[model samples]
Target: MHLDQLNQQYGLPELSFGDRQRGFPVIKIKNRFATAEISLYGGQVLSFQPSNTQADLLFLSDRSHYRPGKAIRGGIPICWPWFGADPDGLGRANHGFARDRLWTVRHTETLANGATRVILSLQDDEETHKIWDYAFELAIAVTVGETLDLELTSHNRDQRPMTITQALHTYFTIGDIQRVKVLGLAGLDYIDKADQEKLKQQIGEVTIQGEVDRIYQNTAPKLFIDDLSLERKIEVCNRNSTTTIVWNPGMEKTATMGDLSPDAYQRFLCVETANAAAETITLAPGERYTLGITYRLL
Candidate 1:
């Protein structure tokens, strides 16, 4: 929908729609508890700042692309149908096509508790079939308030069963990556993506030192990020998610990413809630699954 139509139909005192930087249409929401921005182009939440906080909880790269077919370099990017590289070696996009397509605003409301709710949806079409050949519908409902709550639901619209892996790839802003210690993953086993997919165990709390890319399997439902420099602890809680991915490009890899500066690694860390690897989902026809997560600053 056009910006004017969106504002006409769904705009509220706390929510409005308009073009953002580089002509990207977005939904801007502000309530008594917090403020947030959601880009329709990628169906992604790009910003969320609580009223009690001095900084945003999410990280977005300054040099990130704001165009079609390009995934924004930060925030909560949806990795759907598949996560990471092409699992079938078909040479497709790294994180699937959901984040590269435009999404329709399906619903919006202001909750009784003063939170703002927005739902964006995408369905399989000719263009999507040309890539993956499946009939499906994906919807992400974002509730913005003192805490950010997200629920991604996928439904099988085809006659056959569908298998997929996905994630809520959350890049969290921090005072310093080195000072962040991720709790709740102690003694868990992980697939070290940066170390040639080797299996490793977390001895204690996870920390970022180099190019860290590990997928913790069968993860705990809740995790915490202790940011000593920021003097805060961010709580990550999830349901129906079996895997957690922790990543940072470090210095050397950051130099190659045009969307990220060399020092960008120090400002954010990714702690993803996902159904990937051994946790991939298979849905029968007319079936659906939902992945839910909530982020709170404490």
Candidate 2:
């Protein structure tokens, strides 16, 4: 939609539009409770900071690509249809095409409690068929308030049943990786992607020391990030998500990524809410599934 039409239909006093570094359209939300920025190119929430906090709850890379076709380095990237490497060896993008396409702003509203709600959607088209030949509709509703809440819904628009793996790949800001501890995943089986996909059991609260990439299976509904450097406990709660992925590309791997700084791994953490591996979902014709997440400081 054009700028004028978007402003006419969905604009509010606290919401406006601006261009990113490379001309990607971004929706800015500055309400009474918090401030946020959403990029139209990926339908990604790039920044969200509550009014009472001194730091942003999310993280965005300084060297992230702000152009089309390439996924940004941080914040929340919607990995749909599939997650991680090409599951079928199709040589497709690692985390699916949803994050590389433009999304339409479907709706916006200001809640009674002064929170701002914006809904962005992507639907199947001829171009999407070229990548994954399934008719589908995906929508993400973002509520910016004292807390940041996200609800991603997928609707099967085809005749046949569809099975898929997906994730809300959220990158959160931290004072220091070494001083952070993740709680509520103490005793679950995890697939260690960094250790040759070995299956292991968690022994205690997770801590970041070096390269850590594991997908915890059959996860609980909530987790917490205790940041000693920041002196805050951040809550991560989700619904309809059975897996949680914790990843930190250590100094060695971070050097190979063009979009991240050499020492970027020390300042961020990825605790993804997902349906992956043994937790894949199958949707019958016309069925819909929603994965919800909420983040707040406690």
Candidate 3:
């Protein structure tokens, strides 16, 4: 767990470790272009802000508890095996267990491009086997630079095939949730999670009038978060991902969520890259699947 030797070997101050409440390890990376905080508890990225930026691009709730087994309220949460609820009518935790388990840090280095790269791995244990009954290997690789790159790979080690749905649930800091417009989901049919999972078509760019939760399928690989209030746009480039989810708790639900800050709902929006709903992924023995997304400001 010591990085001093690795740091001296790499010739840079690459990684520093600290405890996030209750003695859980958190890794901090200071690269040439940006700095980030990653929690090994769930391989969750808690913060990422580039150089010379006043505010972070990712929104992390100040009210979030840094306890074990509870997922943080913001940032990039890795949702795997299942997205929203139990897929087979069994009562399991919402959004699976990957975000709750501690992951092993496999590699950390400064890349040739001067970017910081960190790799983490997690495998099924007795607890996970009791819940999901699947043997698999999951790895998350994140590259920090002017732009953020997150890639998640899942490999099946079992003799049988299994299906799973996942998402890189990302919370982005916005100037105002009421004024931000989500582009690139227009003209696509989506499953509206807010309206009893009704099928609907997005007539134009998305506007959040109330609480919204929709899953758009077969979407374009590129999306944009045009923040009119901030006068900045976030370009999102994705690969090997079929579904996109847009969510906001709005005024009412935000009051009910205990983990969110008092004004958290008004300052951030979630535009997740997903393989969920009907677009589930099936992996055979020895097969691997990767889902990746990159975010940058323009």
Candidate 4:
């Protein structure tokens, strides 16, 4: 079906749920120009279909059948306070608590510049504090135009200082993993997951094969994912994030993900902009920080 047609037909469902459990509201933003879907949960982009009829599903919801009732999946999982693997010896689960919680859709408006903005927010609640200590407010504003723009803001409400790491884990669709090439992060220091301590290493252009997971620290201005089969290039630009992660759980790991088909890895690649390792932020009381990423299809 045509992308615009799908938007006009499905837009956003008033109610979206998972197995009787109440899910977040879906916000639909569309005009003659562009079409996009945002979920109140985690303030994630459920789907983005440009004028060209290209659809980019940012998360993989079909990867598992047994929901841990905790760990979140599908569509831009928000990793906050701790990016990956708990550093503070906190066993608060993988990624963090932001994804599983419900977010509020604050406002939606069409800008004069011909772009539409949808803002969503989430504040710390009694349930969240049980897992992590601290009260904070998170705002995620997604602007859709010729390109898809995501802006994340964190406000510290506690009096004490807090250090945190976070990321916008984005899973981009592609034609084939073997036919794709990621440009940028060439010759930069990265943590190789294959080695213990993730031994620091320097690398160049990214090539996919087997189980590849590396965190590239102190990255560059932009990265490009060239999909030869799709005949397209996805340009990623980041703001306020120093580390970028490139990961693809190959055939073996793909099999482990219950919701994913054994060959799912061949059609998706994750190039996430993150704040990990040295990029961790220290937010004082009343302080606010912002991080952004703009994806343009060329």
Candidate 5:
């Protein structure tokens, strides 16, 4: 299906509940330079564009095949405060409250550069505080320009300090996961999720296989995703985030995702620039921290 048709069928006029829970809203923002649609529910980027071309879909949503009750099939799923399953973590869910809450559209302003930025903010509410006690605020400003810019800020308002791990958790669309190569994480120390204590030294390009999940530590500022099928390079540049997560659930795990097609594993790969593992950020009372990832098409 075309991007616009997908939006017309699923896009929201205002905030509304999605599959998983109650009180979430789907928000859409657009301007002359680009059109971006996102749901405050999962903070999922439904569609992004640079000039009229579709930039990213993040996931593949297939209602016909459902696994988890309300989870959508495709589009990026925002993993914040924690990346994957954190059974020992404070919250009951795998990821934190950032993606599940309804975010208010704070403002949308046109920049001097002729680009438009849509700012969305979500604060911890009664429902959130019940699970996680931190009084926090999250602001995400999506700047639509020649390339897409995502600025994420987390503010701690409580009297005590809090430490948390976060990630933009992007599922970049590709021609084939096997044909794609990720660059810029060489010679770094990473804990192979397949084996926790065994730190594998990253020496060359990244290749995905059997339940791959690793946190690349003290990484450089830039990473590249070369998609051979699309004949395009996605340059991912990070600001404020120190760690990068490269993951794909592979064949067996892909079956667990209800919204994903059995063949979905072949079409996408996640090269998430994150602040997880040992890089958990500590926010003092009233202090705020920011992390950004910019996607430039080459």
Candidate 6:
């Protein structure tokens, strides 16, 4: 939509348009309770902070490129069709086209409870068809307030069944990565990506010391991230998510990642709500599925 149309449709003093470095468009959201920033390119939420809080609940990398077609390094990035690598090994982009393509702002609403919600959408196109060959429509509805909620819905338009894996790759700011503790997933089995894909059982809370990337299967709907230094707990609850992914690049790996600042590894933690690996989703024609995630500060 054009800038004038956006301003007209939204018709709110709290919602405005702004551009970042390189002139990429962004939507700024602010109300009486919380504030957020959404980039139209990926329907990505870059920052979310409660009105009375001192820190942003979400994190964004200072060095992340704001150029179009590039995934902004942090916040909540939508990983769809596939996750991580090309499942069929045809050398497609790492996390598919959803994050790289621009999404249309469908509409905006103010809930009765005072939360601001924005909905964005994307559908199959020539570019996406070249890579995945699937007919589908994706919509992401984000609600911001004392809590941040994202509901990603997918509809299968093809006649046959479709199998897919996905994730809401969320980066949460923390006082210190080393002093963080993630709970829930304690007895679940996870495939350790960094440990050569070996399946292991979790005995207790998770604490990171080195490069860690694991997809925990059959995870509970609710989990918690306890930041010792910040003295805050962020509760993550999900629906239609069978897998939870926990990843941190660590010191050595962060040094080689150009998209991230050199010391970026220490400022945030990724706790993803996912449907991945052996927990893939099979959708019949005309069927729809939604991955719902709610982040509440406790």
Q: Pick the candidate with the highest lDDT.
A: 1
Pairs in steric clash, model 4:
59-75, 62-259, 63-259, 63-260, 64-259, 187-203
> Which model, 2 or 3, shows the larger TM-score?
2
| Candidate 5 residue-wise lDDT, 1-298, digit = tens | 2334434543333222233323334445555656656665555666665565554535445542232224344555566666666636544777665666556666656677876666777888888787677788888887766777888888999899988788888877877778888988878889888676578899778876667788899988999988887788889999998799888878898788766787788888878878888888899999988889888887
Better of 1 and 2 by TM-score: 1
Q: Estimate each model's TM-score.
A: 0.99, 0.98, 0.95, 0.88, 0.84, 0.97
**Candidate 1 C-alpha lDDT tens digits along 1-298:** 6789999998999999988775689999989999999998879999999997888999999999887889999999999999999999999998899998999999999999999999999999999998999999999999998899999999999999999999999999989988999999999999999999999999989989989999999898999999999999999998999799999999999999999988999999999999999999999999999999999999
lDDT of 1 at 272: 97
Q: Which stretches of candidate 4 lie over 4 Å from their true place?
A: 1-22, 55-59, 63-72, 200-202
Worst 10 residues of 4 by lDDT: 13-22
Which residue pairs show backbone clashes in model 1?
none
- Comparing 1 with 5 on TM-score, the higher-scoring candidate is 1
Q: Candidates' lDDT values, in order?
A: 0.94, 0.93, 0.88, 0.76, 0.71, 0.89
lDDT against true structure, model 1: 0.94
User: What C-alpha RMSD separates each model from the true structure?
Assistant: 0.7, 0.9, 1.8, 5.0, 5.4, 1.2
Question: Could you tell which candidate, 5 or 6, scores higher by TM-score?
Answer: 6
Best-to-worst order by TM-score is: 1, 2, 6, 3, 4, 5
* Per-residue lDDT value at 287 in model 5: 94
lDDT tens per residue, model 3, 1-298: 4445434443247677767666567788787799998888889898888898777889989888777778888889999889998998889999999998888878887888889888899999999999899999999999999899999999999999999999999999988888999999999999998899999999989988889999998899999999888888999998998799999998888988889966778899999999999889999999999999999988
Off by over 4 Å in 3: 1-12
8: Cα error in model 4, Å: 18
Backbone clashes counted, model 5: 10
Where model 2 places Cα greater than 4 Å from the true spot, the runs are: none
Candidate 5, 221: how far from true, in Å?
Answer: 0.6
